[model samples]
Target chain A: MEPAEVEFLAEKEPVTVIPNFSLDKIYLIGGDLGPFNPGLPMEVPLWLAVNLKQRQKCRIVPPEWMDVEKLEEIREQERREDTFTPMPSPHYMELTKLLLNHASDNIPKADEIRTLVKDIWDTRLAKLRLSADRFVREQETYAKLDNLTLMEINTTAAFFTESLNHMYKLRTNLQPSEGAESQEY
Target chain B: MADELELFEQGSDAGSDEVLLTPAELIHQLEEAWLNEKFAPDLLESKSEIVECVIEQLSHMEENLQRAKKGDLKVSIHRMEIDRIRYVLSSYLRSRLLKIEKFFPHVVEKEKLRAKEDPSALSPEEFAFAKEYLENTEMFLKNVTLKHMPPNLQSIDLLKSVPQPNLDSFVFLRVKERQENILIEPETDEQREYTVDLEEGSQHLIRYKTIAPLVTSGAVQLI
Candidate 1:
C-alpha cells in the first residue's frame, strides 16, 4: 500500500504524549510532528507515540475512547442500534491492543481500560454470534457489517466460513444416494 | 499416479465424484488454505502438495474443456466455475507470494543486486515467479514514496523504517510453556533475562518480534 494509505490509517488513531523536554517543531516527510513542551500532553499518531514511549522520551495518554465509562456507553449504543454504530477508528482493536501492551504504565487506570475493552469485546462477539447464526440459517452469501473493528471482522469471517462448511456438509448428507452417484461419475 | 488418482477420488467422494474438484469444494479448500497460511506461515511448506494437486486437477479440467468443445467427449462442467476457480487460485498464490516477498526483503534486494552474477540464488521456480512479484512491489513502493509522499520523505525507505502493523507490533499472548533464559526488552532501554514462569493461563503483552520463536514452537499464542 502507498504511504498515503498508511498515513490515512494512522491519521485518526491519536495517542497522547507528554514529553520530558521542550523541543521545537520536528519535521517529518508527511508533516511536522511537534513543537513539544515538557509535561504537556499532545496527540500524535500511535506509531510515533509508541516509538517515543519505547525510548522513554514521552509518556502516552490513552485515547478518549479508552475510558471505561465511554466504552460502556458505546457498547450499549451498539446493542440498541439495528445497524453498526460509528466507531472511533476502523483499527480501534489493534490500536488499543498495541497501546495497552506497550504503554500500560503511562495510561491512567490501565486495568480499568483493559477490563472495559474486554467487556466490550465479549459483548460485540456475542452479538456477532447471533448475527452469524441468522446468516447461516438464511444461507446468506454476504453480510454488511457496520462498526466492526478489523479484528472482529477476522473473527467473524472465520466463523462464517465454519458455518458455511457445516451447511455444505448437511446438504451433502441430505442426499446420500445422489452423492454416491455423483462420486462415481 | 494411481495413488494420486485415488487421493483425488477420495476428495471427490466428499462432494461429487467428478474427475476434477467442484467449484464450491475448490473455493472452500482455497479459503481453508488461505486461513492456514495466514495463521501459520511455516505450515505453508506442507500445503505445497495440496496446491500442486489443485493445479493438476485444473489442467485435467482444461483438457476436458478442449475435448468437450471438439464434441469428442460428453463432460458436464460450468465455464463460470472454471473461471472462478482460476481466479481464486491465482489470487491465493499471489497473496502468499507477496507476503514471502515482503518477509524477505533483504534477500530480494540482494538477489536484485547480484541478478546477473547469481541468477540461480533462488530456486528456479521461485526465481521465475518472485522476480516479477519483487519488481511490481518495488515499483509500487517507489511510486508511493517518491511521487505521492512529500519531497523530503522521498528518500525514506518505507519497508526499512515503518513498523509492520501486525507482524512486528505488540501482541497479548498467553504462555503455554515454562520458558527459561529468554531475553526481552521492556519499556526501559535495558535488556533483561527472565524465565517466563507465568502460570500457564497468565497473559502478557509482548512485542511479537520478541516472542516469534516461542509462538512457532507453540510455547505461546497470541490472545
Candidate 2:
C-alpha cells in the first residue's frame, strides 16, 4: 500500500491530523540554514512509531484490497493452518528504502527512523537468526556434492535464489539510513 | 489510495484523502514553537510528562479507530511484502520437507528396483548430497520460525515507543471484535473495540468514539 493511501486513512479523523505544508513550507517555517535557526533534534520517536507499526502488521500476503477485518481473519487462518510466514513486499520494500533515503537527507525525522530500523529487527530476530543458520548448513551441504543429479542441483539453486532475495529485502528494510545514501539536510 | 501528500499540495478537497500536517504548516508551527519558550521548558524539565500522559490516553483510542478503519494497514503491508519472499522460500521448504518425509520410502523403492534386476545403483556422492540437503533444510526452516529462540523474545527492536495516546485509543479495536458491551470503569476503563475485515487489503476510517478532536480548525502543532 502507498504511504499516501495509509496517510489518507490516518487523516480522516481530525484529532491526529498533521499539517500538510509543502517543502517550501519547510524552508519558510524552519527558516534557511541561518545562525538564528535553532536546529531541532530529530523526532526519533515519531519516525520509529511509523516504522514499527509497519512491522507489527507484517503478513504473508500482499494487501491488494483486503480490509482490516479480512486481514485479521487471514492471519488467524494461516496461524491455524500452520502455514503463516512473514516477509516484506518488494514494492513496499522499495518505498521503505525511499522513505529511509528521504528521511536521511531531508526529513529531520532521521533519529526516529533509526529507532524504527532497530525495532523491526528486534521483532524478527527469531526469523533472521534461523535463516542465517540454515544458510550455513546449505553451503556446507552444497560443497559435499561431487556428482549431482539434475533435480538436486535445481533444488539447491532455487533455495539459494530465494534466500538471496529474502536476505536482500530484509537488509534493505531493516537497515538504518546512515552513510549509505548521502543526503545533505 | 490517493497520495496524501498530493492532496495537501493541491489544497482542493482530496476526496477524503487526509495528511498528518501540510509540510509547510507543520514546519511553520515548529518554528513558532521554537520562538516561544516551549522547547526550553521541554528540554529543561523532564520531557512534557503531563502532556505525554494525556497523549498516552488519547493515542490508545486513536490507534483503535484507525486500525478499525484501515484494518491494521501497517501489518497488512508488511505481510504482503513478505509474500514475495515467502513464495520462493515456501516452495523450497515444501520440496525439502517432502524429500525428508519420503526418505525411507525412497530407500525401499531403490531396494525393490535392485531386486527386480533393474539396478539403479546409488553412488556415495548421491547419498551424501541427499543427507546434507535434509539436514540443512531442517536447520533453515527452524531458524526462520524462531524455534531455536524463545517465542516471545523481543526479536525486533521498535523504532519508537508506542504513543501513549495511541495505546489508549486501541480500546476501540477490541470493541469491533466481541461486540460485547464495552466496560468503561473510571479507574481502568476500557474503551469499545471494533474490528474491520480487509479481505481485499482495503479499509476505511472510523471516527473515534470517546475523545473529541483536539486541534479544532487551528494551525497544526509542529512538535
Candidate 3:
C-alpha cells in the first residue's frame, strides 16, 4: 500500500478548476474528467488541476481546509486529545506543501496558511518527540502510533533503530559472550 | 591508469595495503553509490564492485577491532566509523535488494516475453543477487519454522508472500518534455491514453510505477 499521505492526496483530495474554455469530456486512466466550461467551477483531482493551472487553461480553487482559523481550531483540539484527532485528510501536510508551492496565487491568505501549517506541524512534532522519548526510556518493544504521518515516520525511524541497537547491545552484555566461547572452542 | 593499477594491486594484496581509504572517504563513496543507484538504477553496473570493496574494508576494520578488544591495538575512534560504514552499507544493499525483489516478477515476465538475456531494468549481477537473497531468506524461514513453529505452517511459501515494494508508491515529479499519447493502466481501471503537456516546471503526484520508464529516460524527475 502507498503511504496514507500519498494515497490521500492522489485519490481523495479534490481541487476546484475554473477552465478558460469549453471542452468535452476527456478520458483518463482513473476515469472521464470533464465537460469543462469557461469561468465555471468544476472539481478535479489535484494532479489534473495543477496540470491545467500550469498550462494556463484553468485557475485552481483551494480547498476549505487550508483556512488558518480552521487549522488553529483543529490544532487546539489535537493538543487536547489523548489520542490523535482525525485530520481533514491523511495527506494534509503534503497537500498543503504542494498547493502552497504550486498554487499560492490561487489560495486566499497563502502566507497565513503557510504559517498556520508550520505551527500545526511543530506542535504535532513536539508531541511525537515526547512519545518517542517515553518509548525509548520505557524500552517498549511495540507501539501503536496512531495518526503518525509518513514524514514523521521517516524522521523517527533512524532514532528508533539506534535506540533498538543500543538496547540489543545492553542485552548482549548481560549474556555470556557467544563469540568468545565459539572462538575458544 | 597508475591509480587504477595501484588499487588493483592493493585489492590483490588484501591486508598488505596499509593506507586504505579513510572512514570518511568510504562513507562518502557509499552515499554516492546509493544516490547513483536511486537516481539511475539501470546505470548501476559498478554496484557489485563497490559492495565488494566496502566488504573488504569492513573485514579489515573488524580485524582491527578484534585486536583492539584484546588490548593488542589502540583504535577506539575507528569503532564508531566501522559501525557507521556497516549501517550505511547494509541500508544501501537493502534498498537495492528491495527494488530487485519488487521488480523480479516484472523482469522475469519481460525476459520471457522478449526472449532476451538482459532484462533492461536490472543488471545481471543485481538479478542474480536478488535471486540468491530470496532463496537464502526462504531457507532461513524454513529452518526457523522447523525449529520453532508447527509443521502445519511448513507448506506455506513465505518467499512468495514477500510483498513487492513501492507497487502503489506515489511521487511528486516534474515533466521535462512534452510526452505525447502515453498509455497508463490504473489499478482499478482499463488502460487509457493521454497527451501530457510539458509546460516547464509543471509538477504532479503520479504513481511511480506509471512514470518509472519516463524517469529512467530523463523525461521526468522526482522532486
Candidate 4:
C-alpha cells in the first residue's frame, strides 16, 4: 500500500506499519534508509506526498485550487538534470587541509575546531551569495552575456552548481565532528 | 503534581532511557505555555518566560545536533528539523570559524617570520584588508536567515491534515485550479476530489501560493 494507506492504518490501529516490501524498491534519496525509515508510527512518509515530482514514473496529479503553470514549473525543476562543473572556491584547498589534519588528530578543543571549519564553510558560502547577488545586481550585464562572445550564463550556472555541491560536501563532512543537539521535543 | 513527579522519576530511570518526547508532545508543551499565558496568567509568572525556557532548551539541542554531524553524538531522525534550523542560523558563524582554521597554517607562518618586525611596520593596506575581510564575513553570515514557514504555521489544525494518498492537498483554497479533480491513482482510475474554500481575513497571511509538491507517478493534480 502507498504511504497514505499506511498513515490511515497508523491512526486507526496505533500499531507500527511498515511499507510492503517491494524488491524493486525505489531509492528516493541516497544513503541508508536508517534515519528516515523507522516504521510507520514515527514518520508517515510525508516526503512521499510532498516530494512528488522527484518520483521516477509518477505524474503530478495537480490540485484544482492553484495555478497549473506554477505546478508544472516546480515539476520541471525537480526533473531537470543539472550539468556539474567543479567551481572550486579559493579557500577549498585550505579548508580541506585543515579538515584532514584535524580529523587525523583528535582535536582537544572541539568548539575551536568547529569554529574553524565553520568559518571556511561560511567563506565559500559568502562567495556563492555574492555571485548570486552580483547576478541580480548586474542583471543587465548578466543578460548581456547572451550577446557576448563568451557564454557567461552557462559559466554562471556552472559556478553555482559547483559551489553548491562543494558547500553540501563540506556540510556533510563537517557534520560528523559536530555533536547532535536534541533541539526538538 | 504526584504524576508529574512520577514522570520526572521515570524519565531518569536507566530502563526508561528510551523515553523521549514526540513532536506532538513538544507542540503541546508550547500550546500549554500559550494557554497558561492567556487564561491562567497567575498560574505562571508569564507565558513569554515559559516559551523562553523552551527556546533556550531548543537552542542547546541545536548545538548537540551540530555535534551529531561530527559523529560525536548520536541523533534520532525526528529531531533533524530542529537541528536543521539551528544549523542554518549558525552556518555563517561556522564558516567564519572554518576560514580561520583553514588559514591557520598561513597565519602561523606569517607570524613566525614577522615576529621580529615592529607592529607599526605593516602598511595601512594590510590593516584595511584585515578589517574588510572580517566585515564581509559577518555580512555574509547575517544574510543566511531561515525562510521556510516555521513548524508553528501547521499548529492550528496540525492533526486534521493527515497524510493519505489521494488525500486532498487543497485545504484553504477552491477545489479545482485548472484540472477538474486531482488524480491520486490515474491509471487505476482512483481519484479524490475536494473543493477549496478559504477564509477572508487569513488571505493576507495565508493563500494558495502553490499546490503542495506532489509525490508520485500517476499522481496528477491541478493547481
TM-score, first chain, each model: 0.70, 0.23, 0.77, 0.22
| RMSD from true fold, candidate 4 | 26.8
lDDT of 2 by residue, A1-185 (tens): 12432332222111111212111111111112111112322221122224423443111111231223433443444335422133222122223343444334333444554444334333334333444466454332111111121222222333443454344345346343321222111
Instruction: Estimate, for each residue in B1-223, the C-alpha lDDT of model 4 and write its tens digit.
Output: 0011111111212233332443334434444333222211011211232234345556665665666555221243325434433432243223333333333323233434664422321224333443455455435434442223365542221112211111211111112123323322211123233333322211110111123321111011111
Prediction 1: B-chain TM-score: 0.41
lDDT of 1 at B98: 57
- lDDT by residue (B1-223, candidate 2, tens digit) is 1111222221223233344543233333322322121111111111122223223323443454456446543334333323422332333234333333344234323434565333222323334554566456456546775475677852432112111111111100111112222223221123233332312221111222221111111111111
- Per-model root-mean-square deviation over C-alphas: 26.8, 29.3, 22.2, 26.8
Q: Model 3, DockQ value? A: 0.02
Docking band of candidate 1 = incorrect
The 0-to-1 C-alpha lDDT of every candidate, in the order given, reads 0.55, 0.29, 0.56, 0.29
Residue A22 displacement in candidate 4 (angstroms): 13
List TM-scores of chain B, every candidate: 0.41, 0.16, 0.46, 0.20
What lDDT score is found at residue B173 in candidate 2?
11
* Interface DockQ of candidate 4: 0.02
- lDDT: worst 10-residue window of model 4 chain B: B1-10
**Candidate 4 accuracy as TM-score:** 0.19
Better of 1 and 2 by DockQ: 2
Q: Candidate 1, which segments miss by more than 4 Å at Cα?
A: A1-12, A22-31, A79-83, A162-185, B1-127, B130-223
Clash counts for the predictions, in order? 2, 75, 0, 64
- By TM-score, the better pick of 3 and 4 is 3
Could you give the DockQ of candidate 2?
0.03
**Residue B65 lDDT (model 4):** 65
